[model samples]
Target: MSGIKRTMIILPATLVYFLVMLDSSIISTAIPQITDEFNSLLDVGWYGSAYQLASSAFVPLAGKIYIFFPIKWSFIVFFTVFELGSALCGAAQSSPMLIVGRAIAGLGASGLMNGILTILAAILPPHKLPRVMGLNVALGQVGLACGPLIGGALTEYATWRWCFYINLPVGALVGALLLSLRIPEINTKPPAYEVLHTAMSSMDLFGLVLLWPSAIMFFLALQWGGNQYAWNSAMVIGLFVGAAITSGLFLTWEYHYGDNALLPFSMLRNRVIYSASATMFFFMGVMLTAYYYLPIYFQAVKGDSPLMSGVHILPSIISQVLVTMSTGTLIQRVGYYLPNVLTGTALASIAYGLYSTFSPSTSVGKWIGYQIIGGAGSGATSPGSYIAIQNSVPRAAIPTAMAILILCQNLGSAIFLTVAQSIFSNSLQNHLRTQAPGVDVQAVIQGGARMLRPLVPAQELPSVLQAYSRAIDAVMYLGAGLGVAAFGCAWGLGFKDIRKKGEEGK
Candidate 1:
């Protein structure tokens, strides 16, 4: 395709991805309104996690569907499902209803990014893919980074329901645009019975069944381990044991299923894809941990309202948007992606180190600068994984590689959130016990971030505030550790220039 024709297809596809990702994190700022309306404080974890769990579990299946089916029609089906879920969320009268909506939406989202990148690979040449891939990721990051900002605005000025309702029109527009776009088509699928057989075999339904149980049991164990139940309690231990057994079973099934498995064992043996996945895993863990806890720092420690906290975090997301776009362009021009990865990881590490220094009364300028540093690092490296997938694999395998990369990103988010929350909770309780002995720690825990100041007496408020900042800093320290881990993984990418098909870069 000509450059202009390719750009036309890329724009609408990228917008779809942007909306998919925006919904993922936008709920962060609107949780207060959601909980207040439904009176379900206990279900807050499910609000975000349901979407994540469903999205993570269905991704491999989505990848298989994209391969066996036509991209355009497959995309339309997923988008329709996503739109239906959005409408359900906007009209939800109960917390569980909204959680169900989010899960449905996640089911739809599971395939959108994979399909978007797959379409781009089909239409664009290797030399130009990285720049546009970066652009797509940059836009997606904007949606994720600004989700809190947009959701908070809607929640404060309009209604939290608008946060989801907004997707309806945008999806409608993209749905129309997709009708006219041209993308590469796979081999002709057989008849209906053959399609059903493909779903059973190629889609690896048994592997998916095992995968969901394994992921859910594992996630529940992590989520409830130190918070709802003691880590060593029978419930938590049983969940972990269930997770391990199911996971082992899933692995055995995948190995037996061979090339047609959800995550093809043969495909993963590639050194580049394996190492690139690890790099993305660590990077995503850092991103989710930092993005999530920094907001808590703004709310619990800095005394910002949820809306104001979103405004305060804009410097970070804005910086990320700029850096991610430019990094892609730079890689296209210079021919090697490793330099950008190295630079971004180092800056993110530094950003975490700076975040660990936040106090109850950090200077405004200092916080803003720290956000910029963190955002830039994330932006610089975010596109590298996508670039790596296209560069290392044949075009036919792009969907599968994209699936693996995205699965890592989702898994990273889910696992890191569980770990960071534990770190924050344990550290806060320890601080409260030592620093503010007279305060009712359990009451503060139930009351949550917005309730802390109101729950504590004036004399103990300062100590409690300090405790919050220190606890948040402990989470930042975890982000710093992830940064170090990601930095090490990046070196394993083995230097390459996407623009030069036969050339390797040192």
Candidate 2:
């Protein structure tokens, strides 16, 4: 590919990836409004779960599909499909329908991380890959960092539905730009029959069958356990057992079948890949858990409106964008990954620790400081992790390695939020019982609305609100603990700075 062609492909691909990522976090602050509008707080959990589950379930599958298809056309197919899903979400009238739409979008989005990476590797030299990947990472961070602010503004000034609707035009434009660019095409014809035969011979069909159920069951169990069902209830127990059994089978299958496997066990054998993937899992979990729950602390405990809550979270997003941009450019210049990883992780750990001290009485200045620390940490680590993983592997292993990284990330995110929320509930109940002896702690815990709204009697409202604040603080503290663990994992990352001109230049 020539300079202009490469620029066109990279720039547009970056934009599309950014928009998809933005969509993931954008609707969070609007959840309360959606729940209220639909009168289905019970179903709100599905909104996030549907997207996450679909993305996790199908991402690896997309990786396999890319083996038999052109990268350029595959992207066009997936991005268009994703845009269609987004449009459906914007037009959705019911909670279930919205979830279905989100799932469809997830299905398309499942392909994105791997898609861009594959394209970058094919066109760019090994050394230049990091800088391009860094650019991709920066674009994604831009989406993540800007999501809340954009979502909040849209939700506040117009409507929450616009959050999903907004993706349509952006996606279309990105797709158009990518399609118009004339890029070099690889001449290898996909050995579809042979690839399929090999895939069937080597792949674990049993594991594939078990994968979705295990994920779905585990997610549902988390959503319901403690919040909807008692931890020891028959329903929760059955779901948990099903998830464990299915997951065990999947693992066993993967272990037995290495190369022809859906998940290559040999890829996991790479020390650097293993360590980097594990670190990604831990931090992705911690970061996502915070994203899901932090706004609740602002809205439920601090009495901020949804739009205001989103606005409040904006600083962290903005700071992360700035940090990621600088980090990306520097990585292009530096040719190593360790310094950024160590520095970012150390800063993030401190930020998370500081955030754990949050209370209703915590000042705005203090909150901003905490967010800045965390944002900068995020900026440093996000690109740093991707660069490490991409740089460590050879071209042959790139797709599988990227797939594992994303899978670990999604699974970590799903597991952490479920576990974190469970921890929060158990702690909150204990705190409420001791503090408000006569209050209906169960009611307040189950529906947090009574604690949030002005409709509740003014006399008991203060105590209820106070309890809510304490509960929020406890969850934040718990998240902080998780973040500290993530930072420790981040510190373990072998940082090798790969500068823009390549490692040889340094």
TM-score for each prediction? 0.94, 0.91
Q: Taking the tens digit of each residue's C-alpha lDDT, what string does model 1 give over 1-506?
A: 77777778888899998998799878777775575567654455566667777778988988888888888888888889889889999999898899899889988888887889878877776666777788888889888888888987888788989989999999989999888887766444456577786677767898999999999898788777777899999999999999999999999999989999999988889877877888888888777666666766787788777788889999998999888778878888887888888888889999999999999889999999999999999998888877877888887888888888788777777677667767777788899999999998887776767677778999999999999899889989989888888888888777876667723321
For model 2, the superposed segments whose C-alpha errors exceed 4 Å read 42-45, 182-189, 193-199, 202-206, 424-451, 495-506
Candidate with top TM-score is: 1
lDDT of 2 at 187: 39
Q: Which whole-number lDDT from 0 to 100 does residue 440 have in model 1?
A: 89
lDDT of each: 0.83, 0.73
Q: Model 2 — which ten-residue stretch has the worst lDDT?
A: 446-455
Candidate 1 backbone clash number: 0
Model 2 lDDT, full chain set: 0.73
Please state every model's RMSD to the true fold in angstroms.
2.5, 2.8
